[model samples]
Target: MKKLVFIFALSSFALTACSKPENKPVQESAQTAPQESAQTAESTAASQPLAAGDTAETSLDWAGEYKGVFPCADCEGIKMELELKSDKTYELTEEYLGKGAGKEFKSKGTFSFDTKNPSIITLDKAAENRKFFIGENFAEARDMETGEAIDSQLNYKLTKEAN
Candidate 1:
């Protein structure tokens, strides 16, 4: 336990030493900032009511089932049903429409929101890094290769089903 504590102390010291140089400019500016300007900035910030920025990530009731028939090149269409849970897990089922003698393909896995863009989600281990852009009442499937919203006239959208 002594060795472990010493290693942790050394790691903390190294991290603090590495970060101090990068913070020098910000620290210098704060130290030299005018007192009156700082007071004015604080008062201005306090006077204005804080705006609640409600984004899709924070506001949308997104945990539910979504279903739609997406366009397919080889078959008539592809019917996909997806269920998103609050625990960052998902259940997906797909069936090729008008393709006879085939069973519904089902898969379940954990999903994660994009770190930089929380409005999008990608299911773990999905083919081609399949992603979806979540929006109001829909989760649109994005292009597998480009990871962008599909721009075709044919709808690739899944409508949220009322529970």
Candidate 2:
């Protein structure tokens, strides 16, 4: 009976010793997870700023004959011809036919950009106000003609047309 009691006490000690501790170092590392994440975030945020000489080159690569049409619901169909100049300015001529009034319009404008996501082009013209949304590969513009708002968006795929 004494040997049996000794064996039972030894088994109990072995079981208790083999079990995991109530406080683990692995779990304590998990508690510091938020601090590690905050440090990573701070490091990333500190690394992104526009350096000097980061200004984009502004030139007229848009010197071509662009044909556009306004497909608005309540108005006549309008046709536009945009001639871009070598000096980053533009000449706009438009013709409207179908419903409200029949007229031809002409304007001259200069464009400038803002380098945010989906950049902007501000057009200063003689008879109309215009704004263009400038992207990496394409551009679109909205303008007012004879007190009517005309919005046009174009996605350009460059191809050589036969002369």
Q: List the lowest-lDDT window of 10 residues for candidate 1.
A: 49-58
lDDT of each: 0.83, 0.56
Query: Can you list the residue pairs that collide in candidate 2?
Result: none
Error of 2 at 83 (Å): 2.5
The segments of candidate 2 whose C-alpha lies over 4 angstroms from its true place after superposition are 1-46, 50-60, 100-102, 115-118, 142-163
Local accuracy of candidate 2 as per-residue lDDT tens digits, 1-163: 9999999999999888766454465677778888899999889768977543343334334444455665535556666666555576877777785774568888887855545522445557563556554434334554433222243353322221122
The residue-by-residue lDDT of candidate 1 on 28-135, one tens digit each, is 777777776888989987998544444555788889999999887877888899999999889998888775326578888888877656778888885335799999
Model number with the top lDDT: 1
- The worst-scoring run of ten residues by lDDT in candidate 2 lies at 154-163
